[model samples]
Target: MGRRKSHGSSKSKQHVTHQRQLSLAKRNEINALCEKLFVCEYAFHTALSINSAYVTQLWDNYVEISTILEKVKRLEEMKTESPKRSQGIGQFINWLKENGANLDGASVAEFPGYDLGLKAERNFQENELILRIPRGLIFSTHNAAPELIAILNDPLIQHMPQVALAIALLIERHKENSKWKPYLDILPTTYMTVLYMTAADMIELKGSPTLEAALKQCRNIARQYSYFNKVFQNNNNAVSAILRDVFTYERYW
Candidate 1:
């Protein structure tokens, strides 16, 4: 081979080697980061479940959260049957204890609700809150370990959408109430997943331009608001109220 060709070939080989190393390193870093994030997310939701106040709200609007409860039950059952799956759950919790240090840890103070750390600049769009996901989602313990992963799996979340929709519609429908109005300011991360799932379902079912428009609008609205933390503020009462007023099984039935 000519000297110039040989030199180019050597450089190309080095570049390929470097690229491979970088890709491996990136994947490892992402995996580590995801583990920590799963913990933080799990801790927040776990905190949400423990508070009596939220539980009472859920009870009052029993129908709204019925789906969510079902999904949780399915997940709980999976954990019981599979030790490896359960171990993933444990690792997630440990990650929370370690990495969630910086987030607001005043679970007692935030009773019935907690914020996962997400910052949004002013006038962010609605779709920003809507999780980007592929259809037909399924989650095992590994994906469930991180909160984001769980959120990604939310559409496949089994039973949460009806309740989530009730909450969102309540906020949108009850535009007059000052207290309830703010809840609509941003969709919660959990609810955002539900919304995406719902939209995805609708897209698949009808493929209607109207539904497509609605999904697009919802995403745009989400972007304008920022992440769910600023908007939701853990208002279980708000959720309950929406569930009671807006959603009846008959409507879905």
Candidate 2:
């Protein structure tokens, strides 16, 4: 990190009242966690490669993590239950076809161990079209901009198209008359992404750079969460106007 050039501004800053503010304790906690994560990385490279004591100490963390991984892996491999996601597949497929998708030869089905996928109902020649979605049916920041026009000037939405699309998806999902209801309804309540990993699960990546990457990502997300937490609380932009009242962070995620 480089030092910022002073532009003759006062060192002491004014604290403007906000409808929401990041809690001092949570801010401190995030700082502490980031420090600890960096320290772990520092400890990794602190000693020379020839240091036996260093290697031995790191090995203990490895063994602890490996035990949990093996148990989890074994349990998953042994599981026989293959739950088919049949909740709203029919409705979603019907909705897609009704709109503009070409699916005469393809249908969605759940295979064992594979949650859900498109299955061929009949043979098709090479390069034949099996599906086509209309522009109006596709979800993207471009299509969703009108609903979020009030926050278009906000830097986060301007810079992060993915975030904007995600917010739009959530907004639509909450509406009783959403066009994407059938599709969203069939989606899982949660996913197994790194965000879903627990702190203990993070330990499994101890010796890997992935651990640091995950930590950095978590801290970054936390900071952003605080920023948006304030935004949703204080501003009455399209996003804040409707979300501020019922916005649980989980849905935002």
Candidate 3:
């Protein structure tokens, strides 16, 4: 009986060790894939000025890279049973207060159903300013890279605020040690927008009018991105900064 118990314990220990090894291996694989994706992204940006056909191929590669990145990010999020905001979030709120935001009666709180939300600390009268966020704290295309800003100022692209903002948001998102890092850290890594949903998820919305609208918006944004890619292909500065195929339906939504 003693021998049997000892053998069983050994087996259990081996099993646990195997699981840890598998987890480590998976993590290493993901890291390798992420590196490859970055390389692909760099190559795609470099090819933007070559030709339309080559650019299209590179764009497809970029889409694949993005899709894989999204999957890995989702997997990482799922592994965490209880997701908590980073310390940067608290700093961000403090920064907001210091930068002229007024948080008097309302405080940012975590609720059961609503994730992070504004809650009333006390009874408030009508028309009272519970919270005030300064305009400078807001992220917009106006603060995008100089190259992107120049492109946005173009007579043709200037009229398309949505496209311009989406591009700017993506550019800022990829920046290393960005000024908005604190706020960006608190932002969701994934969205429930129709653009990111799988076909099975879309099935839930079958026959809904909003689905058609979502599809239309996707096509319109893709068309706009394509037009801009062709028009700015000769501009090396703009083309180098521009991330092709990033203006996805998810980004627009």
Candidate 4:
């Protein structure tokens, strides 16, 4: 008798073909939405002056894309997701202790699938201080402003104190003998920001107005980045000199 024909391989092939088709369709839909975005973006870029209309149009586009993307999508691997535990954390703690910052009862601990978190070693009563970080440990705008005084007149730095502080951070991080090296070294490279979101992830937020806010923020940041890039390229000053070589949109974001 002839060996019985197995249908499993044929079914598997059919499943593979279906998935390919679905993936191709999804890609085409996403591409079309992106193209729409480009067209709206170009209109704004080329306009004589930006107005509410351009932003509204783009926002509408984001809403459309977000709505489509918010649909049920699925996939993930067994590989667990978690922020990396920095080796510098220990050194940072030691440095803080040496500097009179008290964290004697709290320790940095890693939880599975979560970022490095400070775990309380001992419970405390109300009104009691849980921990204390010295003023020197704080990288405040007060500390950042003096270093960026050269470009303080620039509108970006003048209006945006946060931008000034950010630049200050860049300078400190770049320094060989930076006092904040331990803190900076322990800082996670990734953040829970919209810039890091996958298209699918953005889709998950589709129904919410927060999606629009996130998109607007992204657009504004891109514009600021372009402006800064131009300034850094042409302007030669104390801040620009250092940043022109090292400042990057990725780092800025």
Best by TM-score: 4
Q: Evaluate all candidate structures by whole-model CA lDDT and list the values in order.
A: 0.29, 0.54, 0.49, 0.56
For each candidate, what TM-score against the reference?
0.16, 0.64, 0.54, 0.65
Candidate 3 lDDT tens digits, 35-111:
45444432334443445455345445535655665654443332212135443357567767877889887766667
The global Cα lDDT (0 to 1) of model 2 is 0.54
- For model 2, the stretches where C-alpha displacement exceeds 4 angstroms are 1-85
**Could you give the C-alpha RMSD of every candidate to the true structure, in order shown?**
25.8, 14.3, 15.4, 15.9
For candidate 1, the TM-score is 0.16
Q: Please give, for residues 1-253, the per-residue lDDT of candidate 1 as tens digits.
A: 0000000111112211011122445334433432332222111243432355543332333223334323422322211111211223333333334533222321111113453323332444654442222221222223222322223333422345433343334333333322211122222323333233442354452433344344333332232222222223223444333322222211111
Q: Can you list the residue pairs that collide in candidate 4?
A: none
- lDDT of candidate 3 at residue 30, scale 0 to 100: 48
Sort by lDDT, best first. 4, 2, 3, 1
lDDT (C-alpha) at residue 58 in model 1: 29
Candidate 4: deviation at residue 206, Å? Answer: 4.1
TM-score of 4: 0.65
Query: What would the per-residue lDDT of candidate 2 be over residues 96-154, giving only the tens digit for each residue?
Result: 98888878889888777767788999999999998888898787766643667777777
Cα lDDT tens digits for candidate 4, 144-224: 435577777889888987777777777665444556656655566667788667656766775565765777665555555
Worst 10 residues of 3 by lDDT: 1-10
lDDT of 4 at 131: 87
